[model samples]
Target: MAVSLTASGAAPQPDDAATELRARVERFVRTRVIPQESVLDAGGPAAGAALRELRSLARTEGLWALPLPAELGGGGLPFSVYAQLAEAEGASDHGPAALGSATLLDVTMLARHAGTRVRERYLEPLVSGEIRTCYAMTEADVPGTDPLLTGTRGGYAADGGWRITGRKWFTSGAGAADLVTVLARTSGAPGDREGLSLLLVPTDSPGFRIVRELPVLGAAGQYEIELDDVRVPGDHLIGEAGRALAVAGERLALGRTLRCLRWLGQAQRAFDLMCARAATRSGSRGALADHQLVQQHVFDALLALRTTRPLVHEAVALIAAGQDARTEVGLAKVAAARMLQQVTDSAIQVHGAAGLGPDTPLPALFRGGRAARILDGPDELHITTVARRILRDYGPQAVTPG
Candidate 1:
């Protein structure tokens, strides 16, 4: 396929290796992953069966533990290369959806913070899919957005272990997780980034209790948890105390990027649906495709996706080269979220109410589109982070490059 450049940035050009990888992953998504999407949405045994199938398939294809470095037996592709496969996965509703508990993002965070021993024990199983992990970062109540009013607290225990006490909510994939990684203030004063610590806890351990699952906008839900003085060996601590949040912030960026690419896939799917409907749906000017207004919306959605695709490419290139992409990645997150949201909204509007019904895929696609807005720090926070950097480096000439 001859694809043109999307934005002012370079095109989404993949090396031979990346191209091959993308094709392989695309095949997996089509033949194996997408089938799981329906089973997962069905819940119960269907979901479990889907998970079993996906894990086995992912392992057989050697598509497991994608984000880990090559030394760790991962594909070691650049984030850009990863984006291509992720976008393809998300393009279909199935995302090659998961059967077992825990998000891949949670597993990645473990690779970033867990100690070597911890990595050998839990990390290996997690990468190998023997054990699943979930990130318990969101809190129930407090100024968690700012961290000044966090209710989660952690303290060193007498037995050289640590005890964490707090209530957490909106933890994705927590219900069936085997290993739960969480964040709490261990020593730092209020608002101090230094006091926060990331603890790796076992779900079956005493004091670690899952409260309940709360329905999100879509079919899958997030679980609320209460960590009551959860105790773990000192070795359970991920990285040095107070560094977890910082490390998490950095790691979360990767998670956000992966999610953005997923939205790209979903948006593409939505666009395909919109195009198909437009081709056959009757309108005053004959088919909807012949209507000027319909054409405008269709063109706009494609153009927006086209432009946003390259921003992601640029971010990937920077990251692959070992360059810091704090600004560009944040920018991509914001843009992708906005573009996908607009694209899906337009698709629904064009579909005329039928898009809003469960009879069609547009409804779920639209709901999933909503997550792009806040799944990664939200657009505002990421924009602010980008803005601050621009100002800090350029003095009074702090104009955002976007």
Candidate 2:
């Protein structure tokens, strides 16, 4: 089916084929994904094994290639339909869309710009689950700040190869990746945008090092990369030099849309679990589901999900149509990330000790809650984007694109 999209994020009037395709993918995800919850919660070799198994199941079921283009063996659904499938996948804890996996945001950006050779080489394996890649751009130098201030450096080698240096950390899934997309400064003094570039570097190249895995509130963050003289073939660069920032910019626009969608899923998951737990737990006189405070949190979680889901849909529609929804994405990221955290925290509150104990998925879910803040783009960065957009054009008349 040819999927049409506009910038308004509207769902193209769905046909029977689209509905059936989505339903099939959903069933496969629920059946193959949800049952592995405990393995994912533990977050280790076992979690890796479970994910590997699910990847195969998803591939066999035609669910593995949902996000890629048909040329690369993907289902080629429109972004709108893909967003919906992502929402469903996002709900599960152990499948491809789970928090531990390659986020839709990062991969989509690469899929857009990566050369066909790169796609066949790297992207193909990733979609096929033959190899998993990670993204490493955040660093101790910037320490949660701008990439412009990033200290990682990449330069040419004597054999027309590339050598990368500098310290980087907080890279998601880096510990388990076969390769990593690393962004680094190619020119120290170049004032123009030409100074940055994206590199597709193999993780095992000599001189590359993993200092340690960062621990986020208890869950392992995968890797803290410390690079020194890590060298690779000059062709290691993913795209042209001087466009690294641009690639990242484009990535964030698509990334935030997917991130918003994921946040919606996360909020709903917390709400569902909270409601079920509240209905079963006993309080003074009856089930906690009817208790005043429990009900309040439950309603609050539901409200957050309802409030954000449509906005995400709207934003995604606009993005799919090629509308410039930078402002919308910024707004959505701030709202969705904050709301998911609140919802998950409330879920923990309602579930009592079950929420805190590793015995239940609540604790891991809570970690996923906090993780929403760091994904796509940091919440604070987008908030700053909103503020700058506002202050720079503070008027009833919308800011005209310069």
Candidate 3:
């Protein structure tokens, strides 16, 4: 089925092509990816080889990098179309990476702000999956959600480069990344938003070190990195100096939106598992599905999954249109994160002891759901941000007591 492109170059309505693409992704995740969860979770050369094989198959099948442009060796689909397809891919945690489409956020950011030399050096390799990159902005002593508290500093070096010094934690995928985008203060004091700048640092650079892996919910992907006088060329700065906040914000908006969609997919997966279990498992009374309490669990999980999906898509539409979606993104982020967590927890309860074990994907999904709320900015931070922005419109009249 050929997906017809709308006049605005967007997939405003799902077409045959979009439906076909989504079906292919769903099949790939269900048949190919989910079955290998155990091997993938084991984490070694065999796991790495398995992922490489999957990527090869994805490429051969023309399902690789659907979110990227054709010039970059992708399917050239717009974000709106990609969001719908991403839900299918999100059924497995490794779906995007295995399909070689995980670089969307980094690629977009670099395309917009990276210097010519930087782009020439990294862009193709990144898009082609030859190298991996990580974003480092959060610090050990600072809350990443609040960029004003950033403590890493980059000073001018005598050799016409920047000498960076600081420690960053929660740099996801840093242990295996080829490059990292580090946020450091170049001018002004800590707590000042104006002086932060983003510098691209190669993982092998002198004085750049991976301090340790900071596991999330017992998973080992995030890392703590230390930069002790790490030096990079003056051209390594992304966009204008002391403007890291602006550049980082662009990436975060898209990142958060993608995450929300992935969470929705996971939630849907858990919901399916829950319903299947309810239909088969029998208690003294009858099948678990016959119990009112179990039926309630099914209903609530479905409700959460059904409701949060559109909120996420709403944010995606705004982002694809190049419009400000802070409020919408915040709303979707909080809702989807909580929805995933709630639905996963209920699913685990339905599965009884089986859910906590490796027999099912519930444990992994539960851990990811818990981390979703905290990563990419915590729920409280997003709640306050959205509330503050919304209240500003009401003025003094809304705040005044009756």
Best by lDDT: 3
lDDT of 2 by residue, 88-181 (tens): 6666645454322344554576667776666656765665556777778888747565677767788998999888898778787787778888
Give candidate 3's total backbone clashes.
Answer: 0
Mind giving the per-residue lDDT tens digits that candidate 1 earns over 186-271?
A: 88677776888888899998998888887778566589999888888898888788777677766666666666677788888789
Off by over 4 Å in 2: 1-14, 43-45, 97-107, 115-117, 190-194, 395-402
- Whole-model lDDT per candidate: 0.74, 0.73, 0.88
Model 3: per-residue Cα lDDT over 27-51, one tens digit each: 9989998888788877789988999
Extract clashing residue pairs from model 1: 33-96, 51-99, 91-265, 94-97, 188-195
Query: Where in model 1 is the C-alpha error above 4 Å?
Result: 1-8, 66-76, 93-108, 283-285, 393-402
Better candidate number, 1 or 3, judged by lDDT: 3
TM-score to true structure, per model = 0.89, 0.88, 0.95
CA deviation > 4 Å runs, candidate 3? 1-12, 397-402
RMSD (Cα, Å) for all candidates, in order, is 3.6, 3.5, 2.9
lDDT, candidate 3, at 69 = 71
Candidates 1 and 2, the one with greater lDDT = 1
Q: Least accurate stretch of 10 residues (summed lDDT) in model 2?
A: 94-103
